[model samples]
Target: MHDSYTEFILPFGSSPNILEEYTNASGGIRTGKLMEHLDSLAGSIAYKHMLGPGVETVGNTKEMGFYIVTAAVERLDMLGPLNPARDLRLSGQVIYTGRSSMEVVVKMETMPGEFDEKEETILLGRFSMVCRDAHTHSARKVHPLAISSPEEQMLYSKGEDMKRKRQTRAQQSLSKVPPNSAEAEALHTYYLKYGQEEELDDISSSSQLVSMGDTRVEKCMLMFPQDRNVHQKIFGGYLMRLAYELGFANGAMFCKSPVRFVALDEISFKLPVPIGSILRLTSHVLHSNASSPQLIHVGVTANVVDVKTGEEQTTNEFRFTWASIDESSQRKVVPETYKEAMLWLEGRRALEMGDEIRGLRTQK
Candidate 1:
């Protein structure tokens, strides 16, 4: 991937022929597919180029599952009037690393695919991500960054500046909650605090998974053979499709009516599943409430692992949430069992956390 600047014209478009498909009509080349294209590049670029070396050793193995920490970035550069037709380029460099987290410097631009001084910067952003141990599916410490280049040094300094600014803002914006603040504690607990060993749940256990009860859970196993790459890896979007499909069925079954996807509450991609691997998707009702328009929170987790390894290290877990709209005048005989009660507790906890986060964000 170090030489990817030339190799990766790279799935920039939705089709095999990005150049022909993303013709002059696609967002006038300034935005649109270009924006989406840039957005998709962050993870791949970070994993491939931002990391120093030995990324493969850290990525996946038999004992440790893959869960790479990810960072967020925003778009930069809007050459609105100047050279509007230019093909943009984005750049990222590994900046800094700590025991558990790493930061990368990312930039976007309206230039050719090549990386040169002439490749003027479009937008500049950075990310802080963490990689976790596979068996426990928990965040773990990592080696400090391995870069010693002048270019790396420069990027590291810039990333540190960004990090400081972000920390200051986060600190000022989110006020500390009092220990007795019920609303605050409920809303921020899962997010702000780590789960205890006893409290933490396993992904493979059906006990932790919600139940459809007597209702059926729908699952679709899709292998996009045509979408296969030389490395035999499946596209993230491909897996995402199967995931949402499974989630849609769970929601539809529970609602017993037409359902619509409202939001992606939380999503985490722990490891990369190969193209042919089976994606065992499970979705169950976390909980639901009677709002003016009812909101049902469904939890979907996809476990896709390499059957060849047959070890804890080969599996990748993805967790996501989908909210559905329940407009059915008719309702099914929903079961009120032990699992439902636990799910209700989890949902309640999530709601409180969300409320607190929003409160903190707004208080800014």
Candidate 2:
């Protein structure tokens, strides 16, 4: 119980001098920057809890060194606006543990000031982290979480449910296997209703027939020392920022107006990005809200390439939800290939789920 949970605090100054490179257009904190902080805080919580008791050094536990890498950011929900002069308080607890994985529930809230209430929870995130041997990069066992309270029990249950949902979603994402369910059928119907009648060519007279290709954006950056974590690998949050910025740009273009970030559905880290690797990010529109017409979904994927050989490997996938400034705006994304069709379907599912979550919150 002594190492079951950990907390971190990031106090903000009164002035706007701390403005970061990724601030939103209105000068508010960018969602990607918040995610970067969450990843680092979650990793710290995992490290602290894995140490059990009587571990002095942060690099080792039980006389063996290990490495922790973010496997996935299951979900990140932004409840309200975060402004300057608001300090952030982050708390993380190890709710569930597997043979080589740990699920940390991280809550981020803003303190209006020193004299204000601390109940303003702005973001809540769930991170899945995997432990590995420092030398061999092989999977390593982690200390099991100790739960002794009812609240902890409830969180443990939720962790289990999230894990199961992740597995189901991953299985559903496979392109080869056709999903045989009512939900999948409904998604297919929705796509056809919003889909274009013909494939978009290079020259289209009407601007309404916007191909998914038109919103495509590509960015490349070198993983420098500043972007690395304690393990010498590129920080998950930095990569998240890159993906988010690209997605934001693409969504803004798709909507032809400024957009507001709604949620981050998921960010999956498939492989570790070593320092000095050339990281490439590709972003494009996946779907648009058929019912609301003002919401759009963007997909951002990351790849790493060897500087010398030019060999490339996929690293991460970041999914974002954005809302157009004008509620009356209507746009359709036409899928050009089967893979693109699947991405569109997935985006629809993400938007639907986000709506459900928002609905539940409203009810509460």
Model 2 ranges with Cα > 4 A deviation: 1-4, 13-16, 19-23, 53-57, 60-63, 114-118, 181-203, 291-293, 307-309
TM-score of each: 0.45, 0.89
Worst 10 residues of 2 by lDDT: 194-203
lDDT of 1 at 64: 43
Backbone clashes under 3 angstroms, per model: 11, 0
Per-residue lDDT of model 1, residues 1-364, tens digit only: 2321211232333233555554543233323344343434545544554344345433443244444545333113222222343554555655666666556545555454333325554444444556656567566676555555787667667667766755653453323322335534543453233233333232124232223354435353655566542234555545545555566667666665545444334444556566666666666666554443455566666666455884433233222333344453223222244344444455544444444544674597
What's model 1's lDDT at 318? Answer: 27
Report the number of the highest-lDDT candidate. 2
The Cα local distance difference test for each model comes to: 0.47, 0.79
**Per-model C-alpha RMSD:** 12.2, 2.8
TM-score of 1: 0.45
Candidate 2's error at 357, in angstroms? 2.0
- 335-362, model 2: which lDDT tens digit per residue? 7777787787788789989999989998
Regions more than 4 Å wrong, model 1: 1-39, 48-97, 100-211, 222-231, 256-262, 268-272, 304-340, 362-364
